[model samples]
Target: MKRRLLLVSNSTLHGGGYLQHCQQQIQDFFGKEVKRILFVPYALHDRDAYTKTARDKFKTLGLCLYHMDVEHTVTATVIFISDVLFFSLFPGYEVESVHETPDPVDAVRKAEGIFIGGGNTFRLLKALYDNKLVTEIKKRVLEDGIPYMGSSAGTNVSTISINTTNDMPIVYPPTFAAIGLVPFNINPHYLDPDPNSKHMGETREQRITQYHEELETPSVLGLREGSMLLVEGNKATLLGSTKARLFQRGKQTTEYEPGSDLSFLLTDAQ
Candidate 1:
C-alpha cells in the first residue's frame, strides 16, 4: 500500500467557492475509484452547517460526503426506591453513556476517502482526540493507503505538529502532536511580508523562524494560498499556481516553485 496525501493551503481561493479552486486536483488524486468521502467537520462550531457546506461542494466533484456525529445516551436503572433516593441526594448525577451511530472508527475503516476541512486547528485536533479517531485515521491513511485530503487546519494536522498554524488555540488537545502523516510541519495560508505596509508585526517567516529556535524541531513548509502538496509514497511534489517557502533550523529560508520535489523534507533527519 502506497501512502497518498493531498494537502491544500486553503480550501477556497480569494474569488472561488468552497473547494472550487482545487476541484480538479482533488478529482485527479482520488480518481474514479473513490466515490465516497468521510468528511471531518469538527474544526468549526456548527457541525451541521459545516457538513452541509462540504457535502454540497463534494457533490459537485462527484463524491458523496458523510460525517459521524457522536451521540450521548443516558440510561438510569432504578432497581429500588433507595436508588431513586440515592439519585435525589446526588443532584444532577445520572448514569451517562456516550455512543456513536456507525462508529467513527468503523467509518474511517470503511471510508473510500477522507477529507478534513479547515477551521480552528485546536478545535479540530481536540475533537479528533475526543472521538479517538486520530489513530484510526492514521492507520487508514498509512496502512490501508487510503487517499487523504486536508485543507488549511486539516493540512496542519497531517504534519508532525500543529504548532505552526496561524489559528489561535481556542481549545487544547491531549498534546500539540498531530497525525504525523508527513514527517515535517506545515504553516498553511502563509503570507509574505508586505514591504510597503506600515504595520508593526512579525511576518509569517519570522514566526516560523522562532519555531526553529527550539531544539529538535522539524522543518516547516509555508504553503502560500492556492498551493498544495501531492505526496505519493515517498515523493512529495508541490502543485498549484504559487510557490512555497521552506524554513529549516539554522539555515536560510528557501522558496520552492510549483512542480518542485520536496521529498527531501520527508526524512527523519529534518
Candidate 2:
C-alpha cells in the first residue's frame, strides 16, 4: 500500500487557535494537487459546528471540505445532534447528509483526499464499523493513494488498536479493532511522569504497560503534544520541536528526538 498520512498528536497547543500550529505542515502534506477534502467528523459531537470550524482551517490550505453520511443533524433550530450508517460524495457540490445517497460504498471510491478529526476513539471506531467505512477508508488511504490527515483520536484510529487511548469506555463498540492504517498503536498526548507532581496515579507509561501485559499489543509511539507523524509509503517521520517516546514489550523504551529518522519504527528490527 502506498499511503500518505499526516497524523497529529493534538489539534491546538496552549492558547493556540484550531489547527494553527500545523497549518503550514498540513498544506505541505496534502500538496497543491488536492483541492477537495472529504471530511469525517464522527469523532466530534457537534458535527456541523466541527465541520464549519474545520472548513475555515482547510480554506487556509486551499482545500474545499465536505462531510459524510449520518442521521439527524445540526441546523438553525437544532444545535447538537448526529447519526451514522452511510456515506456519500458528488461532483461540484456538497451534501447536507447521507440521506441524499442510496449507495455509500461507490461514493467513497471517488474520494481524493480525506480528513478525520479528533475527539473519542471508541466513538470513531464504532461509527466506522457501524457505517462500514473501515474498509473503504483503508482502500482510499492505503491502496488508492488518497492523502489522509488525523489528529488525536483521529490518529488513534490509524493505529492497530485503540487499547492505548486515554478515553473512557463511555460507549461500546463492536470491537477494539481500529483501521490499522499503520502497523502499530499510538498513545497520543503521551505525558512523561510529571517531575514534580505529588499526585500518585498510574503514569502514562505504566498504564500502557498494563495494557500491553493484558493485550500484548504491538509497539506504541507515545506522541507528545506539538509532535506529529508524517508518513509517505512505508516511511514514517517524527516532526516538531519535541521527542516522541517509543514503547515495545521487552524492548528498551526510547525517546526519538525530532529530525531523527523514525522510519525504523515502522518496521521491526532485522
Candidate 3:
C-alpha cells in the first residue's frame, strides 16, 4: 500500500486557535471514513494535557481522539544450585525479562488513523522508542495505509531523521533516525533571515546549509508556519498559504509556493 501522510509545519499559527490554521486540510485529509484517530502526544512533558488539547481539537472535526499509555512489567528469576564438589557452596544466577500488555501495540494495529502532536522532537522520538511504537506505527501507516498526520515535532519524526529539527535536545533518543515516512528530512516552523535584525546567530537557511555539508545527507524541506505537505500515494503537494524552502547538497536553495508539487521528496535520491 502507498503511504498516506499529512505533515504540517506547526499546529497553531500566531493569533490562531490550536490547529486552526490547517483545520480544513486535516479534515479533508482524514475524510469522514476515519471517525477515530489514535493520537500520540509524547512530545510534551505532560502527555495527559497534550492529549486532551489534541482530543478537543480533533473532536471539533468530527473525529474521536484516543491515546495509549503502554504499561509493562519486568520480572527477574533467580536460580540457586548447590555444588557437589564443595559442600555448603552455593551459586546463584539471575535472569531479567519484560512482559508487555497487548493494549499498546494492539491499539496501533486496530487504529484507522494516527495523529502525532507537536512539541520537542527529542522527547517525541525517545517516547516512540521507549514504547516500542516506531516499527508498529511504520507498519500500520506504510503497509496498512492508515492516514497519518503530524505537526511540528511530529512532522520532524515523519521524515528520515530528526537532524533538521529546530527544537533543543532536552533529551536524547536511541538515535536520530525516525519513522522515514518520507525520504527527506524536514525543518518545521522555518523562519527567514531578517535583514534588519541585530541578532548575529546563524539563520535557519544557514543551519540547513550546514546540514547539507554532511556527506550523503538527504534533502531538507524547510516548512514555514501555516504550511503543510499532503502526501497521497506517489504524489506530494505543498498546502496552505505559505511557501516551503528546499535545500540540497551542492545546490542553491529553492522556494516553492502552495500547490507546488513535491513528489520528488518521496524518492531516495536527493
Candidate 4:
C-alpha cells in the first residue's frame, strides 16, 4: 500500500482557516482509511496544544496525535531542561514526557503517517538526528514507503536544511542537519504582502530569497498558510487556492498556478 503525505504550514483550530483546509487535504489523500500520528516537539505552549476537540473532528477520518519524540543522547539533556523549565512554568495540558534513555527508532517505525507541528525547526531536527530517529523516519518514507507530513518547523525540517525560519534564533541548530524528507525548504505563512512596523523583520518572500542565496543547493518552496503539498507514491500536486513559488539554484523564480501538476518536483526530490 502507498502512503500519502500531507505537509501543512502553521495551523490554528480556532482562528486560521488552514485547519479546515488541512482536513480536506488529508481526506483527499488518505480517504476514509487514515491514521494520523502527530509529532509535537514544540508543543511547549500547552500539553494538549492540539486540543481534543480538534483531534476528534479530524479523528472521524482516522486522526490521532502521538506524543512522539526522538529519545537519544542530546534529547536527554533537552528533555531534562524542558521538564524543569517548560513543564513547571505552565502546568495544565498533558505532556508526553518520554524518557531520554529509550530508543526513538521504535517510535518512527510504528508510525504510518507523521505530522510535525510548528516551532523551532532547528532544535527539532537536532533532537531527531541525535536520537537516531531521523534515519528511521527516512527509512519509513523512502524504504518503507510511508507518508511523511510536516508544518511550519515540520515543513522546514523536511528540507535538506532550513537556514532561515520566521522565529528568532533562540537555539543554534546543528549545521546542515535535517530529516531530508523533502528536497525543498519551505517557508510557511509565506508572502506577507504588507509589513508590520513594530517588528524588525523581512517579509516571507524576502527571507526565502536570502535562504536560497545562502544554501544555493536545494530549492525553496513558498507556501502560504492554507496551501499544502500533497504527495502520493512518487507524485505530488498542489492543493488549495494559493499558488506555489519555486526558487531553484541559478534559475529565475517561477510560479506554478494552483491545480498545476507537480510531478516533476516529486521526481527530482526522489
What tens digits encode model 3's per-residue C-alpha lDDT throughout 146-238? Answer: 999999999999889999999999999999999989889999999999999999999999899989888999899999999999999889999
Could you give candidate 1's per-residue lDDT for residues 210-248 as a string of tens digits?
899999899999999999999999999999989999999
Q: Cα deviation of 220 in candidate 1 (Å)? A: 0.5
Pairs with steric clashes in candidate 3: none
RMSD of 4: 13.0
- Output the better candidate (1/4) by TM-score: 1
TM-score of 3: 0.84
Residue ranges of candidate 1 with Cα displaced over 4 Å: 62-102
Tell me the tens digit of each residue's lDDT in model 4 across 125-234: 66666667767777787777766667777777776666645666666655755766666666776765574457666666666666767644567777776678877766
Best by lDDT: 1
**What tens digits encode model 2's per-residue C-alpha lDDT throughout 1-270?**
589999899988778889877775786787656767777777877778887778777764422221221234456113222111111121221322221235445556776777788898888888878888888988888888898888999999887788888888778999998888888888988899989999898999999888768645688899999899999998888987678999887778988987767777677441
Q: Estimated TM-score per prediction?
A: 0.85, 0.83, 0.84, 0.72
Quantify all predictions' global Cα lDDT against the true fold.
0.82, 0.76, 0.82, 0.60
lDDT of 2: 0.76
Question: What are the clash counts of all predictions, listed in order?
Answer: 0, 0, 0, 0
Off by over 4 Å in 2: 62-104, 268-270
